[model samples]
Target: MSLQSSNDGPLDFVKYQNVVDGKLVASSNGETYHNINPSTLETNPEVPLSASDDVDKAVIAAQKAAESWAKVPWDERKKRLMDFADALEAHTEAFSQMLVKGNGRPPLHQKIIYDKLI
Candidate 1:
């Protein structure tokens, strides 16, 4: 039910949903697919199998947000981008472990890559 990474600690069970309109939502038909951990060959989470309807809804949401996003000031946009980068840097270890688990890569390899990037 959950993904466990030795380096990152335990991840609680979660149902991965499609992000539509900045909200987590299931597929229109409630279809799901297993997110299997490659190393352990275990299902950690279930992600939505989005259909055409879900794609349409997501496209609409993006179209609606595009105008406002484009109007944002350059400074504010840069700040937001920096903030996102900072957050990712802060969680590099956890993310590296996740990459290892999901892709069946050696933990050391992932850690090295994360170190180089972050």
Candidate 2:
């Protein structure tokens, strides 16, 4: 199935990866799992299969950031959340398509969910 972004025309093919500590990281074991396209039943490139080590790193990173995150002013935190909402709105279509491709959900259903959640 073809996926297109209204503003960007055809969607560019992208390889998925794991994000850890705000950075894209490969699994320590170099293991990956295929992300199968639901519609086409085609497998995309392998994405990182995060092992226990990766989870440990992620937890440690979150723990380290907890103090600063907790110290942020309420208003600033609200503003940051609003900014994030705006960013999600700007990319709604793209994100919806990603849901379809990644989760094999119908675009309409995904859009509905996005509308409610985002």
Candidate 3:
């Protein structure tokens, strides 16, 4: 899918929404917590927090997917994995920037990502 910019795009932190039990649901308590930026000391609004129950559901769904994913024809799995890798490459630049900003990692980490593209 071609990437399209929407006012709503990156604003949603819970992108996948913590898929649980093959079902998606908002936080049971509708709770959230702030994620502060350490460097700028900026506070981002509380994103929804996934409760333990949600985690269990996610695990069960993953387990179910893995069982089928594992049994998939090996060639098909390899092709799908390659597609995922390509998608990652497409976003590597943004990912590195986000990583540095979020983790305060050394500048070299970005260089490492660039080098990998070689």
Q: Write candidate 1's Cα lDDT for 1-118 as tens digits.
A: 1122235744433546788887778999988887678888876667789999999999999998888889999999898777667766777777787777677888999888887875
RMSD of each: 5.9, 5.9, 4.8
In the predicted model 3, the residue pairs found to clash are: 20-58, 21-57
Winner by TM-score between candidate 2 and candidate 1:
2
Q: Candidate 2: where is the Cα deviation over 4 Å?
A: 1-13
Worst 10 residues of 3 by lDDT: 1-10
Residue 50 C-alpha lDDT in model 3: 80
The digit string of per-residue lDDT tens for model 2 on 26-71 reads: 8989988877887879776677888998889999988977878899
| Candidate maximizing TM-score | 2
Order of candidates by lDDT, top first?
A: 2, 1, 3
Model 3 lDDT, full chain set: 0.62
Q: Number of clashes in every candidate structure? A: 0, 0, 2
| Cα RMSD, model 3 | 4.8
Q: What residue runs in model 1 are displaced by over 4 Å at the alpha carbon?
A: 1-13, 115-118
